[model samples]
Each structure stands twice: as structure tokens, then as C-alpha cells.
Target: MIKKECCYYQSSTVKDDPEDEESIIKGMTPNPLLKKNEWGWAIDPIGFRIALKEIYARYKMPIFVTENGIGVREELNENKTVEDDYRIDYLRAHIEQMKLAMEEGVDVIGYLTWGCTDILSSQGEMKKRYGFMFVNRDESDLRDLKRYKKKSFEWFKNVISTNGKQL
Candidate 1:
């Protein structure tokens, strides 16, 4: 990894706890850096650019965006389709920053979002979903784990097919 200068990079947004001494020392506070969402920090696409530039400058390496996305409160519509415009916008903004990084000579090889299908998160919950495909079952109720393609599914498909030119 060091010789090739290639590594996987993940980006996300975070806010410091008000009561934490480290946060107080660093003067970190909940700001408008990310969208306000109930699940967690909303998407902060510029964070991708900042992190990519800093890492490239420091390591001079190729980066594979391994896991980057937002967890959203998604629900199926009457037609059982998920119109996840939030997810699309989130991905588009991040990808735009990635393009900027490449323009600035950052060797970005690939990108992948977290939880491509609705699955158990690190916290083992299904409510906090980050996926292009939506699974129909939640935790503790595995009656029928039906999978449905979300609106972002075709969006991402086109992105991959066009090499992101269409996006």
C-alpha cells in the first residue's frame, strides 16, 4: 500500500459533543457543515474534497473511495417505490467534489457507497438505511426479505455505465 501509495478512504460528517473536553478544547460545535437529519449527520459533500486533498498532499497516493454515503429515513410509497432524491443529491455532490480532486491531480481510482442494500448497520439496526436497493424486511421481522430497487438504483447504474459522465 505504501509503495503503490494506494489506499481506501471513507468520508463522513461529525459534530462534537458539547460536554466533551476535547471538543471544548478544539472549539468544535454543531454547525451547518452537514444537513440536519434525525439518523445522523446529513451529507457534507465538501468534506470529501477536503479529505481527499489533504490525504493526497500528505501521502501522494491513489485513493479508492470505499464507503461514503448518508443514512436516510426511507419509506416505500404506495407503489412500493422509493423516491430517494436526498440520496441522489448527496451522491451527486460528493462525486462532484471527487471530480474536482481528480482535476487537481489526485489519483482517485474508484468509489463505493456504504450499505449498497438495506442491511444491518454497524449498530445492527435497519431503520438507519444507506442503500441503493431497499430490503423489505426489518430486524426481528424476517417474514419476507423482499428487495426493491430504489430510485437511486437506476441513477447509480447510469452513473456507472456512463463513467459518471451523465451525472
Candidate 2:
């Protein structure tokens, strides 16, 4: 089975009071320990692990993670490169959770990211970028549309080359 799980920001510190029905209905409160994206979504890796475990427990089928990534506002530096350390940290934490899930026998078959290059967001916003390769363009104008690899690109390449062992 194919599962697409996107991790959202959650707070470990704040627990919903079970007695309070409103709290239960309201769901998790967002308290980002790491950082939030441009859209204010929490960058929580634990969500990924929880999703994997829940899906595996319920379905008992091998899962293919088809889409997972973080979107952030990126800007090109003077060197024509994007130093997206936030993206790297986000992916690393999620990947670590996936690895842990695998250790716990989640039966994950494969993993794929949301996008490889910057593009229009689902909300049709170009500023909310998600990709290892930054596309040179904005919401208003398409300036050259050149592709530049972000810092996360090389880090992810190494992670893949090492089969995630180095991560």
C-alpha cells in the first residue's frame, strides 16, 4: 500500500485533557520545538513516526511513502545558492523516524519527496517553496528561471549514497 504522510507541528509538552471533551475535539495544540514553515506548520518528526506506526498496525501491508517534504521561503544568496539548513534538519528528523519505524517492523517499502524543484504551492503561492533545487522565479515574474541547488541537495545526496547510514 502507498501512504503519503505529512508531518505537522505538534507539542509534546501540552497534552489534551481527556476529561475536557472540547480539548479532545480540538486536537493537538501546535508548539513547534524546531521551527515553523512559512505557513506556520510545526516541523515535528514524531508525527511521521506516529503515522507510520498507526498505518502499519492497522493495514499490515508494506508502505511506500510517496510524498514528504517541508516548504519554506527561500532566497538566493550572493553566491547564487540557497543555504536551506532548515530543510535538511526537517528531512533528517523525519528520515530518522522512518528508520526507527523500520527497526520496529513498519514494512516501509520506499520513500519519495514532495518535489525536487521549487514550484507553485498547492495554494498557488510561489513564495512557499519546497525543493532541493531552487527555481529562480517569484509570484509576479519569472526571472531567468535558473535552477540552483540548495545546501540540502548535497546533504541529501550523501544521505542517499550512504543508504542513510551516515545520516
Candidate 3:
């Protein structure tokens, strides 16, 4: 049960509100404490646990977290490495939620991140990246396409090696 954005940016091309309701509902509101991303919205990592509890209560099945990450605008340093502490922070928060859900008896089988390497997004934006590894290519410019490991790579490796205990 992977969770990302609850609300997304509405395209200017679209004429009407997709939900046909105001962005802000009376009782239903987004969390204010979560960190905001480049897209001008916050992601509730705690919601992951809440959602997991609800889903586990309704459907008793082994859950898998697929496609979980943040799309941040970043760049490689002159040393050809990316110090993506933001990605690490995002992942750590969500993983902490998963741990809490597991403590509450949710059967989470596996967790998978969105992308291991930089890839073209559906909107054709390379700047909006969600990857532990950075590919040396842009939207219009395909450079060497060399894969460079980001700071999150080592952190993720440690997390996996510790069976998420370190996280």
C-alpha cells in the first residue's frame, strides 16, 4: 500500500476542477506539519501508518509498498555525485511509518522505491526526479547516461542491510 500525493497540480489545460469540489473541504483537510515539495504541497508520512491500519483492518493481505518517493529538483556536484539528503529524509519518514504500521500488526511484505535511476516522467520533466541513482541525461539532452549513485544510495543500502533496523 504505497502512498504519495493525495492532491496533485491541476493542469491549466483542464477547464474544471477535477473533483468538482473546492480544493479545501470542510472537514477533510491535509496535514499541515508535513514537509512541502517542489510542487507546492506536503506529503503526510504519518498518513501511511493510518492508511495501512485501515487497509489491514478491512483486507487482511500482505501489503507491498511500491512507487514511494519524492520528486525533487537536484543537480550533481562537480565530483559527479548527488547529495540528496532530501530524498533520504523523505524515505526515512515513510519507512518509519511503515515500521509503526508493522508494530501494529500490519503484514507488510516488501517495499519498493519509485525509480532506482533517473527516468523521464510522464509529464516529460527530468528535473522532477525521484531516484537514488542519477542518470547523466536531461529531457532534451542525452549525455553519457552514466549512472551516478546519490547519497541516498549508501543510506538505503545500510537500511536494507540492517533489515530497516537502522532506519
Candidate 4:
């Protein structure tokens, strides 16, 4: 009889050495020096790249980014649209890092955003919205249930049309 064990590592942040002061001064500083979401998660693009490198080195397999997006408190404007430039910026930075990883010989297969349409969060919080399309609803009140394209919608459309070249 043979026994095998498999371990899966999933994290947004990956460090080579946590206690090495020299390594920390070289590049790692324990945490990302970037913006945070409503849930206090660091929006660290550099960390994403580092994680990609680490995973590829370990598994030597193509990586697929299943869920990556920012959750924010969103509201529609008078024109019935959300100017979610922040989301666009977040996606752009992460995509740029992915490209860097690919350039560095990481076999990145696919990249998928968290949500295309506003949906209930994993914690069941409606206020923490993550989507290019805004759904007309609230935590307690289900509004018209209409969907409105946010500013990032068209931007992402362009990104797709160009196959990320425009981004």
C-alpha cells in the first residue's frame, strides 16, 4: 500500500523569509504599503506577483486567477451609474503584475475577476460590493433589481477587446 499527501497553499501574500531582517529590507516588509478594502485587505499588486512566482516555482503548473477584485461601498449617481475608477485601477495594477509574472516565465493560464455583477458578498454583506455592473439593491431593501454599468465596465470592455494590450 502507498500513501500520498497533497498540500494546497492559497494566499494573497507570500514571503520567502519572515524573520530575516536583511531579506525584509531587501524587498519584503511583512505587509503591503497600499490601499485597503472595506474589509481591511491590502490591495497589493506586488504581493500578487510574488505569490505567482512562488506558486509556479513550487508546482510548475499554469496558474489560473479565479477570484480577484476589490470590494467597496458603491452608490449610483444621478445618471444611474457608478464611477468605479477605483475598481478599474485595482484590476489594472493586478493585471500588470500578472503580465510581469508571465514575462518572468510563469505559465499563467487565465484571469477572472471576482464578480461581473454586484452580488451578495461571502459574508452576506451587501455594502461590500465588488462588480463592474451595479445592481440596484441594498442590504435590507431589494430595489428595482436593475443593473447599471459602472465606469469600469466600459474600461474592462476595452481591456478585453484589446486582449489586455490596451491596459
Candidate 5:
């Protein structure tokens, strides 16, 4: 129904209203109040690893890394290519960390990223994209829809097929 445009764009460890301008601002971008390398966007990798470890230790259970995708306003090319290398880098980093965690004896399950196709932002900004398949739709206009799978999509599919060996 109403996915991103409805109320989303939140990637917080602790859930918050995505529609809230203040909350989105605080969560999406770096928190000004926070020190340069204190929290949030300061160093997402360390923070995410610590969080996963803590949570795994507490539950001591099998965990599926169910949602981990990068959001970016993709640019399409004449060949209908949507280059989202930032997203690829984002996922590669997380997958590497996840593999490390599994090596540490964490019963880590599969990791599912946030989006597979572009959608309008909860705050009404299609510009805020998070998907391998680019959907040409913005907040103000739905526009003629087009789904162009990106290199990351192919890269991800290969990674999955090779069972993390492709990375």
C-alpha cells in the first residue's frame, strides 16, 4: 500500500516515525548535536557491528539480517543503466561484516536489503532512492514508470548464487 511515500525512510536501530520531519532529519542525515565520530552517521560500520554482536549475544539465536539497503538518487544513462555504486559499496560493507559475524559463531541467517525498486519517500521525495531497480517516480510526479535493474542488482544476484563467494 503506502510504503516509502506512506511513512518510511527510517533506518534507525530504534524505530521512529518516518514521517516526522525532525525525526527523519535526525536519522537520515548526521546528527549535528552528536560529536563528529560519536554516533549515527559518525561511523555506521562500527555501530552496526556492535549492535549485531550485542543483539546476537543477548538472544544467542539464529538471526536473518533481514533489511540492509542503501538509499540514493540514482542517475540513469542513455542505455537505461541506473548506476548505484554507492548502494553496492554500502551492501558490500555490511555483507562483509555479516560474514565476519557468522565466522564468530553467530547463527546469522540471510540478509535482506530494504528495497528492490525505487519508491517515493515517506517525506514525499522519490529523490531518496533505495533499490537496485530504478523507478522513475518523484514525490510531486508519479511519471511514466520504468524499472531498470542496476549493476548492484546483478552483483548482488551473483553474490547470492556464489554464497558470498562473489564478493
Candidate 6:
């Protein structure tokens, strides 16, 4: 539910909450004080891109999409493979939009997505996962932290191998 409710690349309709985020940055609010993990509202990349264009036009510096992705659960099958199509879809959409943004004259440097492997959870639920590499070990079972490439692994490999040209 948290993942579904979170919108990392929402359009202009999203109400800007930079002021609310200021309190978090200023330590007036407890860590993760905001609703769910939406605490990083000030770090909205879509909003940042719009701001960057103004800076780029004035100073001509390279812009960057520093973060973006969908978080989800990953449990390995007996065969040791992970299916992470959501992450792939998330990146693919953002990349397409980025291409359009660059074509429209934004000097973007690169996109750096978060989390390459499964991580421990905040809510202690074993299902809340986000990674291309799946770790067999969950919050409950410290089983040998086995790893598996997710479905996006091949797709991302092809895109990166082609310098994002194939994408």
C-alpha cells in the first residue's frame, strides 16, 4: 500500500510540499515523521528537473536525475531467479520521459536509481523489497544470503550495453 501510494514522478498536479519537508531537514520533525516514506518530498526529482532547466539555461551545467524507482517485495523461487518487472517498468518510463526532456533541451547528465540488492526493512516485514539482485535471506531467516538476478537484470544489461541506445 505504501509503494502504491507513493508517486516519485508525478506531474504538475502534485501539491509541492517543500516547506513541510524543511521541518524534517531542520530536525523539528522525527525521522520518517512524514506520512509513510514520503518524507523526501523536498527531493522530488520531477520538481528538481524543472528547477534544473532554469539553472541549465542560465549557467549551462549538466543536469542529473539522481534518484527514482518503485519498491517491492522479492522472494526467490526454488530455481534461484527473481522477477522484478516493476523496477524495469519504473526505469523504462522514467527513461522515456527523460529522453523527451533532453530532446526538448535539458542537459541531463545521467540517472542513478536506488538499491541494487535487497535490504533489511524498517517495518520488519520480509516482503518489502526493492532490488535487481534478490537476497534469499529475509528478515526472519538469516539463511545464506543467496542472490539472484531479477527479470530487469537482462533488460537493463541490454540498455546499458548499448549505452541506453537500445532503450
Candidate models: Cα lDDT each: 0.76, 0.80, 0.76, 0.81, 0.65, 0.61
List, residue by residue over 46-138, the lDDT tens digit for candidate 1. 767888888888888788787878786687888787999988988898899999989999998988888679878789888888899988877
Runs of candidate 3 exceeding 4 Å displacement: 1-33
**Per-residue CA lDDT of candidate 2, range 44-84, in tens?**
78878988888789878788887778888889999999999
Q: Stretches of candidate 4 above 4 Å error?
A: 1-32
Q: Once model 6 is optimally superposed onto the true structure by TM-score, how far is the C-alpha of residue 4 displaced, in angstroms?
A: 29
Q: Is candidate 1 or candidate 5 better by lDDT?
A: 1
TM per prediction: 0.84, 0.82, 0.81, 0.82, 0.72, 0.63
At residue 1, what lDDT does model 5 achieve? Answer: 30
Ranking by TM-score: 1, 2, 4, 3, 5, 6
Q: State the lDDT at 141 in candidate 4.
A: 93
State the TM-score for model 6: 0.63
The C-alpha local distance difference test score for the whole of candidate 3 amounts to 0.76
Error of 4 at 60 (Å): 0.6
Instruction: Record all residue pairs in model 3 with backbone atoms less than 3 Å apart, i.e. clashing.
Output: none
Among the numbered candidates, top TM-score falls to 1
Candidate 3, residue 166: Cα displacement in angstroms equals 1.1
lDDT of 4 by residue, 1-167 (tens): 33222222222344676666633344444345456676666678877888888878877777888788888999999999999888999899989998999999998888889889998988898898989999999999998999999999999999999989988
Poorly placed runs, candidate 6 (over 4 Å)? 1-60, 121-126
Off by over 4 Å in 1: 1-27
Give lDDT for model 1: 0.76
Which candidate ranks first by lDDT, i.e. highest? 4
Worst 10 residues of 6 by lDDT: 1-10
| Candidate 6 structure quality by residue, lDDT tens digits, 21-84 | 5354333433342222232332233444455455567666576655566556567777678766
Which residues of candidate 2, in runs, are more than 4 Å off? Answer: 1-28, 31-34
Deviation (Å) of 113 in candidate 6: 1.4
